[model samples]
Target: MEVDYNKISRQYDDVRSADLKLISLFSEEVEMNENTRILDFGCGTGNYADKLQKVTGAKIYGVDPSDGMREKAKAKNSNVVFYKGNDKNIPFDNNFFHFIYMTDVIHHIPEIRVMFNELKRVLKSNGKICIATQSHTQIEKRFYVKYFPTTAKVDKERYPDIEKIISSGKEENLEYINSVTYCDNQLVKVGKEFVNLVERKGYSMFHLIEDSEYKQGLRRLKSEIKEKELELETAGGTLVWFKKK
Candidate 1:
């Protein structure tokens, strides 16, 4: 699927990054020492790059296909190199990176196998690749099904199982050291703003939802929020981190 990079890029940080809980987990798992050469695959708007530079002293290169995202990242860090293209053909030599990362972008890619091999190719031996994506747990899928049914189907079909990723890495001669999964269990209210974003992004990705269904889902979500005196943040998805052996 060709993603509407323009639309998604405009609101990427506001609608998505604010509540991401996996940042800390990824930080813990991927230890970056000084002089670390990093490639942040699908580094939309450099959200993680901003933090990685501050915390790790790693020389970071961000790659994304979104023009809007590349512009924003360049504005933020004038010296940072932000490339525009799909991740599978990263414009770098083999064994050029000490670490690589792709956060919440695994499901968005149409070619997962190619990306896996490409990531392994560029990484130095004993380097690490940390990927944080949605979990394949019943509870995780169930929540999306109830709140955003149309989007749930898209995610279910696209997100590769963490185990599959680990195995693929091994096949490409990248040793898998460990995989850790986390789920944040908490109920937060869902408001109209979030619902609108859900509808826009979800509808664009999956055309299975009708206007009536979208309205009904919003109505139900709002009603539940009011009754529970809550905000629309629910249990967060799990983050799976794998290290290269």
Candidate 2:
């Protein structure tokens, strides 16, 4: 199912926020300074872009296709500039950014090779691109998947494999840097909070599954929550890095 960002923009931030650990990882991988220019590719709601600018004092720019998402991001009262664009056609000039990062965004892009080529066009020589995504194993082990079996299948089909991402970057002359997997030790949501998130279809995967299946899954999830007072556990994913050749 296709997610309508404009429709969901109102409540997007309520369920999602900047993952500080992921931001820290990106900061460590890329050398950001006051003079550095950074682009948040497929930046939804500008959360990461705003946080990154404050953390590194860098010139941050955000590009996303959703007007609603861009509007929300622009309202943050930060120096980060928001633009309406996508991975296929970035509006910036050649060699414009020192670093580009996309958090959990690669799966939505249809053409990985084309994205790498466009990223290369905007990235300065040796500039880095960091992609934070779930590997197949991670997706299979998502906490929600136990209740919603279809989520794992949906995500597995939608998300590109890690090896495929690396090869696409290589084909576009983007050298592979390193890949790291992280498992957050923090509890993201618990009991009723998690149930409410699923009820509202806060996650895109919830929209993809069959309505009957979703309803059944929700019932099962609620039962588990009620019986066990379940606490939604950690979030884990892999961060793939590359550099423009």
Candidate 3:
């Protein structure tokens, strides 16, 4: 199931370009200050580190397992440290980070409790881990679900239920700050944006679908886009934060 991200890493930036505005949703919910030492766990392609650095002026560090991805992250911003690491085996010292956040990355982590243990180790007493992810319950809102059926199907299987996250937090004795689920503003785009986004093949869901199925989906998407402007309502995920006890 391990797709060669070394190849996928190359196109990662082109497709998942940093959206400060979108990232702002995370920032607003987390409410971090300039002095907060943030760890962007599972920082892929380093696209978000610099944008976050610009927004918060905090000492940010990005840790990822992929050297290919780490190299790109390092190249993105020197101020924001990027290195090879993961949740269970982070490179930095214990009680080192004030806040940790991951976007659209938790579903990929197989050992959730192992990660929670590591979070307990490094996160400061005042630190919090903020997770922005799509809950299985919200799958119906996924805008491309019809187009990318496998993506939705895979997500349902992969995405952890909200209760698991909350229960995991409790097991670790981390205080849950509550989880909020809200849909963001819809992306009203014409056909061109829709076509361009699909062509990028940056979405992980696209990787699951067969090539023939993907092509068929693209054709369907394009045809629909051409007929009229598409007001895409991408599914909104959940943000759950936990503070060290």
Candidate 4:
């Protein structure tokens, strides 16, 4: 799936803030010291950077493949050294990071195993790696699949299961830390919110809907949200943290 970096860079904080609470909790779960070095994988616009820094006062390094995203992140946190990187390779040197964070980035990565291996390569002997990803069972996934089948196909193909993620880390010789799950669902205004999300992030690129299809899909979605009490849930990603043995 081709993500619109410019669009997502704009909505980076607003659309993704839901998981910040849980991610923050995961940050606390780690026993970080003052001098810890963190590699924030796919650190879009530095949302996690601020929280992680605030919580641990650790040096932050952000990696994103998108120039737009890296630019935004650099702008947000002047202290953060943002670099461009893709799924297959990270820009950092081997055994350089004390902690690696991959929050909500697994779905966007084209090659999962390569990224996992890269993380393992960069981590210190006892370094920790934390990853957050959307739940397999999510309302948005369900509804979006019904209207636009491509979204489902793309997501399933892109998002590896947490078990697979953990096992991949194990193959890299990292010990399993923990996987935490948290979810919150709340009724929200359907039409306005949906429009806002699309307008903000341009998820349109990911949509198979044409202008005509979008009109019909919007109507159908509105009706569904209205009838079923459409709820925006922060189906928190599985936070799998591991340490290199």
The per-model lDDT (C-alpha) reads: 0.69, 0.88, 0.80, 0.69
The C-alpha TM-scores of every prediction are 0.83, 0.94, 0.91, 0.80
Q: Summarize candidate 4's per-residue lDDT along 48-148 as a digit string, tens digits.
A: 88677766778889888888778877777687788888777787789999888877778776666677777888888888887877655552444445655
User: Which residue pairs show collisions in model 4?
Assistant: 133-237
Ten residues in sequence with the least summed lDDT for candidate 4: 200-209
Evaluation by lDDT, superior candidate among 1 and 4:
4
**For candidate 3, lDDT tens digit of each residue in 1-245?**
54566778887887677756547876776666677888989998777778888878888989888888888888888899887877679888899998888877888888788888887888999778888787886775677778877877887778788889889878988999989775654665557765777897777767777888889989999899888888776566688888897
Order the numbered candidates by TM-score, best leading.
Answer: 2, 3, 1, 4
**Model 1 segments beyond 4 Å from truth?**
18-21, 138-144, 187-193, 196-208, 226-228, 231-235, 243-245
The residue-by-residue lDDT of candidate 2 on 91-189, one tens digit each, is 999999999999978989999999999999999998999999988888887888878898999999989989989999888878999888887445665
Give, for candidate 1, the lowest lDDT window spanning 10 residues. 199-208
Candidate 1, number of clashes: 6
- Relative to the unseen true structure, what is the C-alpha lDDT of residue 118 in candidate 2, on a scale of 0 to 100? 92
lDDT of the structure predicted as candidate 4: 0.69
Those runs of model 3 whose alpha carbons end farther than 4 Å from true positions after fitting are: 29-34, 185-187
> What is the Cα-based lDDT of residue 213 in candidate 3?
81
Whose lDDT is higher: candidate 1's or candidate 2's?
2
Query: Where does candidate 2 have its weakest 10-residue lDDT segment?
Result: 183-192
Over 4 Å off, model 4:
10-14, 139-150, 184-191, 201-205, 208-213, 222-234
